[model samples]
Structure formats: structure tokens, C-alpha cells
Target chain A: MKLGRLNHVGVATPSIADSITLYRETMGAVAIGEPFDLPAQGVKVCFVDTPNAQIELIEPLGDASPIHGFLAKNPGGGQHHLCYEVPDINEAKAWFEAKGARVLGEPRIGAHGTMIFFVHPKDMGGVLTEIMETPKDGH
Target chain B: MKLGRLNHVGVATPSIADSITLYRETMGAVAIGEPFDLPAQGVKVCFVDTPNAQIELIEPLGDASPIHGFLAKNPGGGQHHLCYEVPDINEAKAWFEAKGARVLGEPRIGAHGTMIFFVHPKDMGGVLTEIMETPKDGH
Candidate 1:
């Protein structure tokens, strides 16, 4: 259950375009990836590369988007979650459950195309946490 | 103005001891640092090391602690800020100001013993962002 490298920091934003602009011109981020729609996940996402990790800019895709409530609470956006990689998703899930931490749901393919699951914030020091299986190609 | 590395993620917690336990037992963080008080900053701090970056757990030291308001709003505690390194703190401050983003204050020695300044959340896409001068030994 050792946490691996931090995969990314999820930031829920109202607009990915505006976020990209800020990351580029203001934050001097030079390796931002293209923004793409993830209809199944109900968000548009763009990854801004940092030296060690990434800043995931996520915008609500539809009215029923999961981040809608977060945006309503913080209209200007905010750090939504932190994703950390693990060697195996199921093992991580079981480890968390064994520790009496609530695993939000069954592991599923995540935005990074790897198995992932969310841990309940109440059980994770009030921070939304995502556990992800290391990508096969080592991203 | 290029960003150096993702230095750390700041997590505000009511108790650094409890946070450390969670990180060590549940998160399997093996490199948890000793908790220390920064009286001048009005916060108790501890660092949980990840392969790429660190998680800084902060607890208010007194009534005037800067994070008191944040903890009041989110009693369970929450992600407080994200810090990135820059080669030059002063240059970074000027760059952000020129781009119409408000630098919170003049650069001052931060927890890492490096010069750092914060950018207003409103001007930083809703995330309180800390820009730090890269440590001389390259931490």
C-alpha cells in the first residue's frame, strides 16, 4: 500500500481554456497537453506538465457533471483531488478498506486509462484522494 | 519565469499527529518528517514525502494563524495550497505582477528555508499558489 509518485493534482475549473491560458502565460507552463472531452466522466480535461507531476485542469462537461457542485461552491475553481499511483489498484483498494478507510466505489478505468478508485474524504484527512494503478508505459 | 518543479501540496489539518498517523499507516508513507512548529508563521508543520514531491500537513499554532479561517470553513481540514519552485523568487514575483496577478506579499523565507511568496487565489485560477526560490542544494 505504499504510495508511489503523485500522478497529478486535480483542479476543477469552470473553463479549461482559461485555465490553459493561465497555466501558460502566467504560470509559465510550457508542456500543457491538448484539452479533450471525457463524456463518460462528464468533464473536459487538460494536463499541464510540471517537472515531477502534472496539474490536471478539469471542466464540467454537462449539467450532471460530478464537479458541478464543487464549482458551485467555488465558482472560480480549486484543487479538487490528489491522485497517487500504486502498483496494483485492487491491492490498494483492499489495503484502504482494511485500514477502515472508505473506498468510494469499485475501481474503474480512469482519465489516465488506468484502474483507479477514490477514497472517501472523511477518511482521508478531508482531502479527496484518488488511487491509480501505474500506467503500463510508465507515465 | 519558467516553473521549476512541483515543490509540495499544502494540506491544512487540525492535528498534525493524526495526519501523520494516517499518512504512515494508511497511506504507507515511509518518509514522514518530524512535526515542528514555525512560531513566526503561526503553524505547526510536518512533511510526508512522496517520490516526486511532498505533502505538507499544517496545523494552526494560535488564534492568529493564517489558516484558521480556512479550517473554520472546512472543519475537517482540506487542501490549502500548491507550491512550485522558481529559479528566482523576485523575478517570478515581477512576472506574475506584470501579468496582472497579485503577489500576496514580498518574498520571505519559507518553511523550506527558501524565499517564497504566494499568489492570490482569485488571480491564480482559484488555487492559492506559492512560488519559491529553488533551494541552493536543489531540494
Candidate 2:
């Protein structure tokens, strides 16, 4: 896979508000974005813009949300996955699949409104990996 | 604290050889550096250079290595910490302390042969962050 750039890191948190505070008041991150709900992904998301990359703060949308299990294991929440930009999603998918890695699902609209899919953790050196297509015309 | 850039992502691995295989053979990563031992840190390390940043693969050097605990929890190993370059280690330390965040210890020699310290995950949005002074020269 031709991983373009590390776009952002996914961080699972119990509360986006507290996470935002930690990133802002503590880390002095001034470019935090407004929290938004992503019902399809079963989580609320916020993008903390950094000079070189972004940090995606994820909070479980409901009790049944997939993130709930991760939060249960790590109550304080933790780093979820590392997402990298790819020039062509389909090419990356084909390459990863050919390498015997499992592509979790077909390319779907991600929080950034770009096509994205997750590669299984076991296939990605124990790190759940997200391959995202570069955002078109937007920062 | 003024974060410079994402230096490298530290990934705990059962075997750097296997991890290297994944990055090179599978992920099409080039410029993989030879593995070396960092006895002081109790880990064998390898730096896989990427276009934007590097991936540090860490394996236990001995039975008492700290990574053994993490590897035990995650048999296949997992992502450990995100390391970012800082212009001045001391200034960054003071800034983090003033923010009421815990700086692990005094600056010490890191894998890149630069002064580095870890910020407590509790204060870092549940992510163990490593702050390293920029290396004088490229790795």
C-alpha cells in the first residue's frame, strides 16, 4: 500500500468535551473543531488540527456503540487507530488485500466526507489501520 | 508546548524482523534501517523510515523489559506511543508541568540519541506521548 501521509490519529474518549479540554487547555491546541455526531459510525467525532496532522476524538454514540467495548476495556479511552491518506482508495484496497490483509468493509463515507475503510488490526501489526482517500478540495 | 513535528510512532512488536517484513514486503515500505539494541531502554529497536515520519519497532531486550507487559496483554504487540519533535526539551517540560500534566522523568537519551521524556497518559487524552528534541541531523 502506498500510504500517502498520516492524516490523523483516532482517539476514543468517554466524553468529547473533556477530551477537547485536554487537547486545548492542557495541550494548547487552538484549532479544535466542533463535535459532530456520526450516526453511521456509532460515534461522535471531533478533529483537533495540528501543524502536521489531526487528532480525531471519538466518543461512543450510545450504549450499543462499538466504542463502548473499547471504553469498557480502557475506561479512560485510548488511541484507537492510525489513519493514513491514500491517493486512490481502490488501489490501496486491492494492494492490501493482495498482501493477505483483511479489508473490513467496502469504502464508505468517513467523518471527513471521504471514502475510507479499515484494515484489520491483526493484519496491521496489532494496530487497527484506517486508509482514507484524500479529501477533495477541502482542508 | 511547541510541538515540532511527528517524529516517529513507537510500536511494540514481538519481533522486529516480522514487523519489518510487514512494513516492507506488505506495505511497500522502503528505507528500513537495520535493527539495533537499546539496552538502556531494554528494547531492540528498528527505525522504518517513511516519507513524513518513521515507525520505531520495539521488541523486549530481556525478560525484565517494560514492553513484555504490554506484549503480554497484546500477544501480537500494538501501538505504544506517538513521538513528536520539540524545539527545546526544557521549555516543553516546563509548559507541560504548568498545564498540570505529569512529565514522566528527567530528559534522558531516547532511541534517536536525543533527550526525550514521556507525558503521562492520564493528562494526554489517554495517549502516551513522547517529546523529543529534534535530532541535530537526519536519522
Candidate 3:
């Protein structure tokens, strides 16, 4: 259950376009990826590459999007979650459960196409935490 | 003004000890640092070093602490801010200002003892962003 690198910080935004502009024009970020919709997740995501990690910008894709409530409370967008890589997703889930920490759901394929599961924020010091299996190629 | 690295992600918590336990015991993190109080910042801080970046846990030090209001809103604590390193502090500040982004204050000594300033969340797509000068030693 050893925690790996801090994979990415998920930022929920109202508009990925505007977020891209802020990161590129204002923050002088040059390695931002193009925004793409994840219909299954009901959101659009863009990656802003940093030397150490990436900033994941997410925007709701429809009314029933999972992050709609969050955006309702934070219309301007906000830090949504923190994703940390682990050697094994199942092992991580078992460790969290053993400690009485609530895992949000069964491990499923995440945005990066790796097995991932979320721990309830209440059990994670009020931070939505995602445990992601390290990519097979170690990207 | 090029973004250097994902310096650290600041997490606000009610108790640094509890957060430390979560990271060490539950998350299986072994690089947790001792917690210390920063009277000037009115917060107690601890650094949980990950392979790529660090997680800075901050707890209010007094009633007058700046993060008191945030904690009141999110009593369980939450992700407070994201910090990125820049080549120069003053140059980064001017770059943000010129782009019509509001800098919270003049560059000052931050927890890492490096010159840093914060940009208003409204201008950063709802994320509190800290711009720090690359440490002289580049730790």
C-alpha cells in the first residue's frame, strides 16, 4: 500500500477553455494538452504538464455530471481531488478498508485507463483522494 | 515566468497529528516530517514528502489565523492551495499582474523560506495558486 508519486491534482472548472487560457497565457504554461470530453465520466478534461506532475482541469459535460454539485457551490471552479499512484489498486483498497477508511467504490478504469478507486473525503481529511494503480508503462 | 515544477499542494487540516497518521499509517507514507508552528503565518505546518512533490499540511495556529474562515466553511479541512515554482519571484509577480491577475500580497518569505505570493482564486479558475521563487538550493 505504499503511496507512489502525486499523480495529478484534479481541478474542477466551469470552462476548460478559460482554464486553459489562465494556465497558458497567465501562468506561462506551455505544455498543456488539448481538452477532450470523457462522455462516460460526464466531463471534459485537459492536462497541464508541470515538471514534477500534472494539473488536471475538469469541466462538467452535462447536467448530471458528477462534479455539477461541486461547480454549483464553486461556480468559478476549484481543486476537486488529489490522485496518488500506488503499486496495486486492490492492495490499496484493502489497506484503506482495513483501517476503517471508506473506499468510494470498487476499483474501476480511471481517466488514464488504469484501475482507480476513491476514498471518502471524510476518511481522507476532507480531501477527495483517488488511489490510482501506477500505469503499466510507468508514465 | 515559466512554471518550474509542482512545488507542493497545500492541505488545510484541523489537526496536523491526525493528518500525519492518515498519511503514514493509512497511506503507507514513510517520509513524513515533524510538524512545526509558523507563528508569523498563524499556522502549524508539516511536509509529507512524496516521490515527485510534497503535501503541506497546515492547521490554524490561532483565532486570528487567515485560514480560520476557510476551516469554518470546511471544518474537516480541505485542499488549501497549489504552489508552483518560478525562476524569479518578482518577475512572476509582474507577469501575473500584467495579465490582470490579482496577487494577494507582495512577495514575502513563505513556509519554505522562499519568496512567494498568491494569486486570487477568482483569477486562477477558482484555485488558490502560490507562485514561489525556485529555492537557491533547488530542494
Candidate 4:
């Protein structure tokens, strides 16, 4: 149950374009590609590559996305979660469960081909946290 | 104008003690120190050290702190900001100001002899971003 380096930073915004400008022009992160819609998460997202890692900016496409609810209430900005790289998702989940922390979902595939799991906010005070293991080489 | 590696992740919580437990016992992070009260910020905080950086869990003393407002509005969860390490606070401020980004405050002393500045949320589309520089040794 060791936490690895940060995997990515999740940011919620009304528009991904503005986020790209801010992170790109102000922070000098390299834009990886055009924004893409993830219907499963109900978000349209773009990734920025930093010297060390990446930043993810997401906008909700419809009411079905949780991000849509976040934007509806907050409108402008929100920080989603801090994702930490883990070596083993199942082992981490088992450790959290044994320690009285509730797991929000079973380990599942996430962006960057990593296996990820979320820990409930109640257990984390008020921050949603995710643990992931980078995809093995060659899938 | 480049985002650096993440310096730290800020988590808003009701109890730093409980948050520390989960981060340490489950995630293999070591607590940096006992929770410390930030009177000016109206909160108490503790740090968990990871391989690359640290995570800060903030517990508001009352309704005056920003964390308090964040928790009131979204009791479920919230992330404060992703702080980036910079080499020169003044240069970073100047560079971003030239780009029309709103600088929240002048460089101020931060934890561990660091100089830090915040970019206003309005300028960055709701993310209260920050730039920080480690003070020169023996300065």
C-alpha cells in the first residue's frame, strides 16, 4: 500500500479551451492533443503534459456527468481529485478496506491505461482520492 | 509560463487527524509532523510525505476560513489547488502578469522558507493556482 508519485491533477472548468490556455500559456505545459469527450464519465477532457507529469481539465457534457453537477453549482472552478500512482490496485484496496476506509468502486481501467480505485470522501475528510497503477507495457 | 511538477496537494477536511490516519496507514505516507494551527488562515493542518511531495489536509477553525466555505458548499469533497515549484517568484509573477493573468497577491512567505504567490481563480477559470520558489540557502 505504498503511494507512488502523483499521477495527475484533475481540474473542473466550464470550458476546456480556457483551461488549455491557462495551463499552456501560463504554466508552459505542452498541449498533448485536442479535447475529447468521454461519455462514460460525461466529460470532455484535454491533457497537458508537464515536464514531470500531466494535468487534466474536464468539462461536463450533460447532466449525467458528475462534473455537470459540480459546474451547475460552482460554475467556474473545482478541483476534482489527486491521483497517486500505486504499484498494485487490488492490494491497495484491500489495505484501505481493512483500515476502515470505504472503497467507492472496484478497481477499473482509467485514463493512461492505469487500474484505479477511489476512496470515499468521508474517509478522506473532504477530498476524493484515487490510487492507480500505470498500465503494464504493451497493454 | 510552464507548470512544474506538483509541489503539493491540498485537501479540505473536517479533521486532520482522521485524514492523516488514512493517508499514513493505508497509503504508506509518513506524517511530517503533528497538526499545526494556522491562525491567519483559520485552520489546522498536517502533512503527509510521499515520494515526490506532500499532501496537506486542512481543518477549518471556524466559518471564516476558505476551507470552511468550501466544506459548507460541498460537504462531500473539494481540492484546494495544485501548487507548482518555481525558481523565481518575481519573474513568475511578471511573466504571468504580462500575459493578463490576475496575480492574487504579492509574493509572501510560505511554509519552510518558501516564497509563494497565488493566481486568482477568476483569471484561471476557478482554479486558485500558485507559484512557489524555495528560498536560496542561508537567505
State which docking tier applies to candidate 4: medium
- TM-score-best of 1 and 3: 1
Q: Pick the candidate with the highest TM-score.
A: 1
What TM-score is obtained for chain B in each of the predicted models? 0.97, 0.95, 0.96, 0.83
Higher-lDDT candidate of 1 and 4: 1
State candidate 2's TM-score.
Answer: 0.94
Which 10 consecutive positions of candidate 1 chain A have the poorest summed lDDT? A34-43
| Alpha-carbon TM-score of each model against the true structure | 0.98, 0.94, 0.97, 0.86
Reference-based lDDT, residue A56, model 2: 93
- Candidate 3, residues A1-139, lDDT tens digits: the string is 6768999999999889888888888988889998888887788999999988999999999888999999999999999999999988888888899999999878988878899899999999999999899899875
Full candidate order by TM-score, most accurate first: 1, 3, 2, 4
**Tens digits of per-residue lDDT for model 2, B31-63:** 889999999889999998766778899999988
Q: Which candidate is the best by DockQ?
A: 1
After superposition on all C-alphas, the RMSD of every candidate to the true structure, in Å, is 0.8, 1.6, 1.0, 3.1
lDDT of 4 by residue, B7-123 (tens): 777777766776777667766775466788877557787777776666767788766877877777767546776677787889999998998988886888665458888888777
Candidate 1 C-alpha error for residue A14, in Å: 0.3
lDDT of 1 by residue, B1-139 (tens): 7767999999999999999989999999999988988887789999999999999999999889998999999998899999999998888888999999999878988889999999999998899999989899977
Cα deviation of A83, candidate 1, in Å: 0.2
In terms of docking quality, model 2 is: medium
User: Candidate 1 vs candidate 2: which has greater DockQ?
Assistant: 1
Per residue, candidate 1 scores C-alpha lDDT tens digits across A1-139 of 7868999999999999999989999999999999988887789999999999999999999899999999999999999999999999988998999999999979988888999999999999989999999999987
